[model samples]
Target: MAPATRYASGVSETAASSPLIRRIAHLDMDAFYASCELLRYPQLKGLPVVIGGGRRKEDDLLGKLQAAYPDGDWTEDSFAEKLDRIPVEFFPRIEGYTGRGVITTATYAARQFGIGSAMGLMKAAKLCPQAILLPVDFERYRHFSRSFKSIITDIAPVMQDRGVDEVYIDFTEVPGGQREGGRVLARLIQKSIFDATGLTCSIGVAPNKLIAKMASEFNKPNGISIVHEADLQSLIWPLACRKINGVGPKADEKLKGFGIYTIGELAAREPHWLVEHFGKSYGAWLHEAAWGRDDRPLETESEPVSMSRETTFDRDLHAVRDRAELGAVFTRLCEQVAADLKRKGYEGRTIGIKIRYDNFQAVTRDQSIDGYTHDAQRIRQVAGQCLKRVDLSRRIRLLGVRVGTLVKAGTAPHADKPYIAAEETPYEQADLFFTDD
Candidate 1:
């Protein structure tokens, strides 16, 4: 079984010759979404479970329980309180799934069958048809994400929030940070998170972010690895060139063409040779990254440039036939994006819509307004206008809404002036599909 979560690492310049050494730790949560699901269905432990697709089958599950155990009075409340009572056979399997849905994450047990995140559900079914398929419950996962993150911050004040699953923590000043190269602090933080959320994570402590990021992958679930500045040649350079964080597929392919498949090969090249082939900035970055050199500070506070919400339908939906349903989803996406903006204290002037046709062709359109807003209706109105420009004659497999050109909610130039509201947004044609109706 492979571990789940991925946390970004920090950049440090600590060296053996320097008087000061900075220890940076990169922590990755193990199978975050699947682990959260396991907490709700403990009976599924040690079994192959994959989390993805549509919303949880609450009513469907309750109905199944009522039929299987007529005397149990398995209402929705009972189903929630007694989830463990449900038989394993009652759950849906990936065996016969027919959809464009993708897996968010799968349990370690499922990974043993070659299942992984971002793989289409249908393909996963081919690999492990008997794997239990569960719906993604982001609300529940977010609750656990906050739980574990709060625990980390309580122990170490200087922590970087990477995402819902992983984080980067500065261990230079904390007590016991230098003991065994930050292993003591790492253990404390890992134990604290597990104690609070019943979750496990892997940590890598090193002199800088680049090596730390690579080191975190050395151990699997609930493990730790420590690296020092002196270990760069032995532990880092022999890895593939792609192992360097900055090298993408294209760059790696180019490096391979130049007979530089390993980080050691990249480090051996003259800086001028790399700069001649790659761009000035990127090539220089490649040289530095290959040598495990980074001095970036952890970002404690940050602002987002945009916020969005998107969903892939369980089935392709026709624009006209699924008018009401499409309208509801589009409106929900707008509301969700608006809620995100409000929660983050941001408002945006640019609103956009993205859609994917059954043929897998995707289109995007955006328009900027005079004033910024985080209101759902405003976003829907603009997004609807953007949608009108797109040919929705084909069935849509996915829908998304985005709001960009953001500013702090009360900080836009026209903050005091009232923004004019446009006419209500309509779905299909002007009168054909999406409507208040």
Candidate 2:
């Protein structure tokens, strides 16, 4: 048997291993939405930018500024410098927000003030009064998401789409994967993405997905961490139990009641004890996860379950008093969702609608149709019926539409065909994805 060795960060040492030692990597885009916004407004690179809240009249402040100074010696190079001269009040801030909107995501700079995703805009306002607040732009984010994923799959063929901003990659078979315990390949993928999108991501390499997911966040905003099985006690045991991807708040609370505050504490419990406490299957999984043992493979091809579009209004709109505006917004949301499905080459059988009232109460309704479709008109008709099911008497602060139960477009010759397939890029090939025609 080979002596166990471990790798930390990028360096590797001899470590004990079983018959099978695989290399898995997890990559997470840092502040993805905020970073996408920065690509458009590079001037706000280091600023406390928050992407959340409803739309506001002042949301177009940057546009107004650009138009007002169009002929006034405005140039690309001096854009950031000029932004410094503008008054802070010109930008929309979370401070004093009275809407029922929630923060979709906040930049790390804004996170210092304790504001993060799912926080109420009004509550976040009290923490970072001057943070620049921007509305969510799903269409733009989706473009970047596709671009980055395409770049990754070209370099590493086996990848699992975790979400828009994160992915789990199987590095055991990729070139240079076993070299330096996958760090070399990880760096290649990271640099490739940055070159393609001008965005930074964090990568973590380990023996399996369970540990790789946790290690990815060890160093963030353009950093990488590598771990080996032998170092699990030192590298992973000390972390909080909630750090594990599957451990939610409820599980954490339940674990806490049994005096388990960290992964080590959970690991110390016997499997049978954990099973008795957390049920059989989950308890067994908990034991396996606590020991950093996971055999799940990368899912190379997984169709999306749903796609949706939503927006928060600057002010609440009544259903009866502002029926026309509400109806138009609803129709637009449905059309946007339909467009997303079409663009992604997916068709869904379920249509749904979401609404958040001014009083902070939210409701959703969905109906499944006989067949899958991506037609905007059909989506709007079905979504309109969903809207009728919800009580519209209350003033709504946010509106959304969704389509789920997705399947690949039947017009395709193969089920594995992507809407936008990855292509080989030559050294001289220019990246015009984000450039204006």
Candidate 3:
């Protein structure tokens, strides 16, 4: 929960006039995926809409629109313009959804039904049966992500890209950034994004990233929050320890066990007592976090550690009965991963596969190859070998393939070794049950 408005509205005259006061802003797109979907289907606005499930079939919405309005001048070239005309009744609902897919994001309206990101579709169905279920459209989402981030960089060049829909911007040096403790810059950014994309965002500006992240959530859906170093006690300390960003469920539970629920409680403990209980590094970090102290600067540029792709099936399938289908999907996943790696100019030596059974338990297997290459067939080969180590007798709900231990392509000594497949007998080739693919 957020504290009263005095902290957000008033910055101490002393701190405001200080020679140097760092101001960092965390901007998070509100209901990002769902909002992107709303742009294509404005009729769904203000209605319960959940944006997740599997990938959309090619021109599925176009086909539905054409079928529903045979005489309504719908053409492939004009499909984008006609999206807003789609009838709400034509959308898929969660009422009888049986998939094991989890939501990626949901509209604020649907969230009131307790539907949220990572929640199972079936479970969400029970809460909001009338919620429109749209398959994930990452292509559109990425376009918007790039658009907004580009705008942010144009305004604040020193910005850290956190993910597809969030960023930490250094407002300390930007013009007018210090006015009202960064609220002026935050409001300008919010308006610029909304004007460009018709999307909303919430921003929090604070002395550092730690408190800025928490402040971003204080007022959501196109709201701005400000917190100064002096407001730590009245503003930041009242929030739960879990809101500290790095504190996860396990840490929160352990903190609670020590009678520490709020940041205030954590702050009350002596640094030595916390170090003795939590450990040297984490304990010391906790004490600093509770006091809203973070000296880390924004990381403006970073390389990705790995890349992967995964999908949940419309229904669980047995390994033996679903071998052909599973094999095709398995091969496609490797191809997708390889395509991604090559597109990004990277190669990984480790190949891995993940399996989630009907019971929702997941298992992963991976092996390090002698050389790194972003070759689809080779990835499938090494990944197939890794797959042989997992139990396949049970029904599987989801599958994923990944490559890790990455390096830029051609940077490694054994980067591009030509792959020579061993000629195998039909029995051996078919052994993995993916030969048909």
Candidate 4:
């Protein structure tokens, strides 16, 4: 009798027998919003630059700097050289700028002082008092986001966008995917992006998305890590439970009660025991995650479900006193949403607005239209209506506009013939019936 073929457990028999291995690359921008800001305001390059705050105050600071140096001679490298010439007071004051705005993103230098995204202005100030704080520039960031994604699609057609800052690329069809040359291809992509945009990113190459995401974060700020299936035990097992995608604070606390601190511990538990403790579906997902088994495909062709633009205030502004200024900002957001949709070859049927209050209470309102459209004027009108529904009694820290239910640009074609006869009759029968003697 012939011996049975030994297959890797959990993988499909067909897949195990096949010679091809699916290669996925997860590429994430290094401090995306903050990096883009540095490109425009070169003076912010080496310093700790925080992006997110009130528009007026940010603009005022930008105006002051522009007046002081109107010739645009500040190259990214020259910023540190001329640092002494610029006065300490020339830097924007972090104290009492606007309403209670939080940090959207902080540069590597600011992060060293224990400041990061979503940290309150008060806390961030305590960490890095002299860090250059700048308001978020959504338009500039969006432009760069589009540029990077477009460049990636040009190089690798099978790219799955994971938001403004990251993407999952399918490199299986690229040349030399199965060999050590895969690293070369990844390097080419990284260099291309840097050469084109002067921005840095980190990438991870793995057989699947689950492993790729974790590997990408292994190194930061212009780094790459490659993970092979054979090295899963050494590379993945030691990670903490919270490192897994779906393990939030609640799940982490629950896992801690079970003495499961690492992926290895979670993997050691029997599937039945995990199911009994964590319920059915989530338990199964947890088991698979522990084993690093995610089969989610890289989605290259789907339209975005939503397109949004948001800005964090430098200081929280009162809803009543800032109503007129906020209204103008909201209008600008709608226009940006429309432009984004048009550029991406999509139109949306739903328009919405998001407001985050001083206390961090977020409220949203949306309106669906009769048909999909990408007109900025139409979006603004509908979004303006949605804004009226939200309570404006409290101070708002952030405002955003979003369009959803996207569809491709072109309309569906209508067939000249009826479908009833075509479906009911066989091809040969229909051909005979339609033919003339």
Would you give me the overall lDDT of model 2?
A: 0.75
Model 1, CA-based lDDT: 0.79
| lDDT, candidates in the order shown | 0.79, 0.75, 0.80, 0.72
Cα error, residue 262 of model 2, in Å, equals 0.5
- Misplaced by over 4 Å in model 1 are 1-20, 302-437
Candidate 3 lDDT (Cα, 0 to 1): 0.80
TM-score, per-candidate, Cα-based: 0.65, 0.61, 0.65, 0.62
- Collision count for each candidate, in order: 5, 7, 0, 8
lDDT of 4 by residue, 1-437 (tens): 00000111112223435665667789999999989877766656788878777663544544566678789655546654554455546778565544688999999988998989998887787777788877777777899999999988888887888988999987766765556625776788889999999999998888777888888899998988888776678999899989887889899899999999999899888865886798755775687688777655566555454687877676777666765576667667877988998898877767777676664445666676656777776777667666667677777777887777567765412222212322344422322111121
- Whichever of 3 and 4 has more TM-score, that candidate is 3
Q: Which candidate has the highest lDDT of all?
A: 3
Instruction: Write model 2 residue lDDT over 327-349, tens digit each, in one string.
Output: 77877787798889889898877
Candidate 1 lDDT over residue span 1-437, tens digit each: 00000111211111233333578888989999999988878989999999999887678888877887888868766667888777889888999999899999999999999999999999999999999999998999899989998898788877788899988887876887888999999999989988888999999998766777888878978999998877888988889988877788999899999999999899888865886799655765677677676645466665554677888787789888898789889889999999999998999887777676665445667777778899887788778877877787898877888887678988998787646555444333333224322
* Top-down lDDT ranking: 3, 1, 2, 4
Off by over 4 Å in 4: 1-18, 56-58, 62-89, 95-99, 302-437
lDDT of 4: 0.72
- Ten residues in sequence with the least summed lDDT for candidate 3: 1-10
